[model samples]
Target: MDLRIIWFWMVGILIIGYAILDGFDFGVGILSLFARDEKERRLHMNAIGPVWDGNEVWLLTGGGALFAAFPVVYAAVFSGFYIALMLLLAALIFRAVSFEFRGKVDSSVWRRVWDLAFGIGSLLPAVLFGVAIGNILHGVPIDASGTDVGSFLEMLNPFSIGVGVLSLVLFVMHGAIYLADKSEGDLQTRCRTRASQAWMLFVVLYIVMTIWSWIGSPFLFENSLQNPLFYILFVVLIGAIVFLPIVLKSGKMGRAFLISSLLIAAMLGEMALSLFPRLVPSSIDLSNSLTIYNASSTPLTLKTMLIIALIGIPCVIGYSVFIHYVFRGKIELTEESY
Candidate 1:
């Protein structure tokens, strides 16, 4: 296979890894805001405390891979989405800060303020990520030089916003299932109820976003329809969606969480299949699009990077597995707990 093609899929896998691992962390943070009391809120935070930062390693790795393998696309996207990315950065920073600072002070107001920060921080990224994907699918106004010339506000068009909401609902559902798995009694019941509610919303938004994407970005369907892998992923996505409710209803929280994670992976896989070689489609002119072929680094650079990635990615996987293994099972809040 071509090295560029290899790196393209490699980058896609890294992104999917990040989305699946850290997605529930965002969900848990958002759900923390709805906790009935301080203990419940701490439960939400502590559920993901150990693995959250480690899960984010996939994101950093994905970004580094993008920059290494597709410098032109990286440059174009980073420059175009500068302000939005800054907002995302700020949100993540605040969320991280809240984890530490919220526990330090005994004051209700201080903890409340940090709690709000954590919730908003999680909420913004959940929406923004979907919006970013929406814009990429809907196509951006990339000029001849391959830079996105569109204004920041243009990124928030109706279709993109709908996609953003869809993403938020999906994450909330994922988080609720995870929380349900990690709690017992009243909290678990509440988490299960939230998961079911979020599932309903996710279904509605999924249908709406599909229709909107069909209307706004018909080109995405063209390649996807022709690819056999798309059909396979589509089947898995639908199956996961269908079985999620059944598992949730049966109180199989772990299975429900697994189904939700599969749902996320399948959805992202569908997006990758639709995108194929195109990294950033140009609204101005399709010919100006940045594709895997057009935007990739030199062959030697790709080869060298592939060698490094081969050795490094497994280490990340091993560490992630080890951390999760150590932190597995229901959360038990102790004096040292977040």
Candidate 2:
């Protein structure tokens, strides 16, 4: 296989893994904002407590994979999106600390403060991630030197913000499904209700975003449409999205959650297919855009990395699977719980 293509898919898998795993963690945190009381808040926190950190490792590995496999793209994205990435880092730090410190104090005020931090921390990253991807999909202002010529505020156009809102809704729904899966009693019922609401919101926003992308980001479909298989995938994507709510309403939390995860994977898959060859397209100079051929490492280097990945990735997957299997049940708050 062409290592560039292989690495591209590998990197995409790592990102999808992060989105599927930490996506729900971020979702849990976003949902935590709506908790009725400290008990409800703790239920939200503990829903993801066992797996959030482990989930983050996929992102770290994805970064490393990007840096190693596609150095030029890494340099361009990291430097061009420096401020955005830093904000994500800051939010992640604050969010992680909140998990530990929120339970340290029994005071309602202290818990409330951490709750606020946790919610904002989780929410910002989800919105910003979509905004960044929106910019990528919309094309960034990359000059000859591959610098983002656009100002920071310039990055926040209506389309990008709409994409951000779409992402937020998606995460909220994803988190709701997870909460429904991992919570109990009134909280579980409330989570299921929230999931249904989030799903309805997602359908509306998904339509709007689809219209926007069809108009503004038409390139995403142009190449993909050349292949008939893309249409099959789209059908599958729609089917999964449609089937999710039915399963949720049936009180099958595990099945609903599985469908949600698959739905996320399908969405990511579409993005990957649409974004193939070009990692980041440029608005200022199309020729300056980073592509797999222009942005990747040498073939020998890629082969070595693949060998390493073949060994390392399975270990990561095994470890992640093990963690989930160990924690596979509704959360019960104990002295040891978050």
lDDT of 2 by residue, 50-159 (tens): 88999999999999999999998888888877888899999999999998998887787998889989999999999998898788888888888766777767778898
lDDT of 2 at 324: 87
RMSD of each: 0.9, 1.2
Best by lDDT: 1
Query: Model 1 off-target regions past 4 Å?
Result: none
Question: Candidate 1's residue-wise lDDT over 1-338, tens digit each?
Answer: 99999998999999899888889999999999889998999999999999999988898999999999999989988889888899999999999899899999899999999999999999999999888888898898899988889888988888888888888999999999999999999999988999999999999889888888888888889877988899999999999999999999999898898899999999998998898889899989988999999999999999999999999999999999899889889999999997
Candidate 2 residue runs with Cα over 4 Å from true position: none
How many steric overlaps are in each model, in order? Answer: 0, 0
List clashing residue pairs in candidate 2. Answer: none
